[model samples]
Target: MARLPEPLTPLIQRTSIRQVGRILSNTQLSPFSMEMRISWNAPQTLPVPGQFFTILPCRYPLTLLRRPFAYSAVTESWFAFIYDIVGPATRDMAKLKAEDDADWIGPLGRGFPLPSPDVKPILVAGGAGVGPVFFLSNVLAGRGSAHLVVIGAREAKRLIRLEWPSHAEVRLCAEDGGTGITGTVIDGIGQQDMADKVFYSCGPAPMMAAVHRLAAECGCPSWVSVEEMMACGVGACQGCAVAAAGNGGPQEYKRICDEGPVFASGDLIW
Candidate 1:
């Protein structure tokens, strides 16, 4: 495994879960993806930018486990999640109509630390990982923080081109050179001065590992949002355990949904 830089512990606060939510709109973004905006009635508080939720489909039976999805964006009364259709759960979710109900449990897990106004923020995302990272990017914009955004996908169509804040510099990458650069998202990072900036990333493990490696090389502390096969979406299942970073001691494991779906980059033994 590649060595990643040590990351700062994120600011954490536990959030209550909502039992039900109504879908306001469910629009297909591409052949395999869709975006849903939902009304959760009254949330204890708005979810921090990097948090995720576990959504249970009221209509699916074969799929017993709730699907975990990161918040792509949020508003006062509504929140959005973007998902790619890969299994029975998501395929059923795609059939949700406006006014349909979906059970939800979240704003679960730790979120990325807020960046200081004086620090430049850089966000890197690949594939479906764009969901959370884009939310964080919007939060940065709301804070009046300028940022650089790098996104990668298998092809141009897989890449998301959202209306990011005007202050953000967006870079695109595709493995097939179908959109921007011809390489991985890590290749898009190039040789920018990461040392002076705060870095946040989410994606396939290999991509994130590369990002963390680059951060280590540049002496940049980073935060990473990770994905795992989840069962309960809460601590009860004891599923989704990931190894903790560091050796020379007892090996430790952290639960993805309960302990985090987000963590300081190098803290995970990737």
Candidate 2:
């Protein structure tokens, strides 16, 4: 794990900023989709992937709400994220043009670990889960490990925005049968050999639960990031707790904020 920077440490709890830069999507989806990237005037690199940064509304909007999104990708020059603009916070992001800014705080929670070279990797995602998977995919590809990526959506149009690896084999699934593969992305995994692969997954609770089952069936290891309603992104407020197995096979609670947004397969309970 990388050490947290001192400057970013304080801002981890602050929200709202003077607004900074805006990023535009090169193309729109059937309805509309745009990639939004914002930069903080704060003096540092945004936190690592799997962690998130929040964008607080400035006085002009008066919505006064903050929207949190993951650290999708980063370079020395900039950090990026993908947005579908389905709601207010993202809708605000679509409105800003270049040169405006949004305050950023992160690299929060632990990121998914890559599979060791001796094992193949399988990446699965649904909806916005695509954002973080893209970040993970690029990193693994650079190191020369091949990843089989499966993305799922309700229908062809609802499929999430993604920037995929140049060398990876990509598969998409639409429940209504209109994209790369028909049915669930889970179907994509069934068609392949899981004998020597490890899995990484994210998305809806039911979806993650299902992937957890599949990984166990194949005798493969798996990890996942949980998405829960949150107030404070850190441990202080205690908003995001996951169910874990307690001492008598009874239920226990684990904080997603302090402990993880990411967890090993055995760490979670249905």
Candidate 3:
């Protein structure tokens, strides 16, 4: 069951517009994350890297349901979301302030696919999923491609500081060893070199099911970015169902807000 690869499909067909976005800076990166920074008015397309976006607060309306996130760092006009305040609609979206006004929608769902240039792309992030694996390791270092990011946190002020990706090759786990390579992220994917590498995970859910069981025991080929809990980011509220691997009948369910918050870790059911 390892023949997945073919889900990138989004050259255009993006029409989601609730629109408003204007905040522009909210700060506080770790110790429970939060990076807000919106402004984007360019929306006919623009959100790649495990796409997602939902926001809805407009002067603190607590929670009616729009919260989704992901897509940390984009710039045609502006975009950035690194959330993790946890409750009360992300603590009222960190009390938004720089010019306030929020009520978005997005380049929603399905993203993170681009890995067949002869393997080697790793990624992995955890907790606030380090903003779409630092926006997919800066789009795999702007396509020059040398990748391998890792990230993970649980100490060291709960990491997530951002501004990495100078050509990727980061790695900073910290399950309390205080920083860089101490534990978790499966001990930084067990010190890398997973043969022809391909993984591309994103935060919790047992750390993306232990990086898809160590990328299927190193036979490598993985992808995930699911994070659930949505009332309706789209897909009309099937309520973010997950769990679907092969035959269970009727495709057994799949819609982390519309067919994926990026999938293909052997197509779910972990």
Q: Best lDDT goes to which candidate? A: 1
Q: Whole-model lDDT for model 1 versus the true structure?
A: 0.80
Model 1: how far residue 126 lies from native, Å: 1.4
lDDT of each: 0.80, 0.67, 0.79
Q: Lowest-lDDT window of 10 residues in candidate 3?
A: 4-13
For model 2, the superposed segments whose C-alpha errors exceed 4 Å read: 1-33, 40-46, 59-65
* lDDT measured at residue 208 in model 1 versus the true structure, 0 to 100: 89
**lDDT (Cα) of model 3:** 0.79
The better-scoring model by lDDT among 1 and 3 is 1
User: Which pairs of residues clash in candidate 1, taking residues 3 or more apart in a chain or in different chains?
Assistant: none
Task: List, residue by residue over 1-270, the lDDT tens digit for candidate 3.
Answer: 233344456722366667787787899876688888888777666778888878887898757777788887788888887878878778777877899988888877778877765667778887888888888788778878787788887787788867786788788888888878888888886754666677888888888888888888777789888887887787886878887887656667877878788877877877
Q: Per-prediction RMSD in angstroms?
A: 3.2, 5.5, 15.9
For residues 1-270, could you state the per-residue lDDT of candidate 1 as single tens digits?
Answer: 112322324345565566787889999877777889889765657777677888887666567777889999988788898888888778888998999888888778777777766678789997678889888888788878898999988878887667788878999999988878889877887766555676789888998888888777777778889887798877788889899886779998898888788887778886
List the candidates' TM-scores in order: 0.92, 0.83, 0.35
Candidate No. with top TM-score: 1
Order the candidates by TM-score, highest first — what do you get? 1, 2, 3
Which ranking of candidates, highest lDDT first? 1, 3, 2
- TM-score of structure candidate 2: 0.83
Which model, 1 or 2, shows the larger lDDT? 1
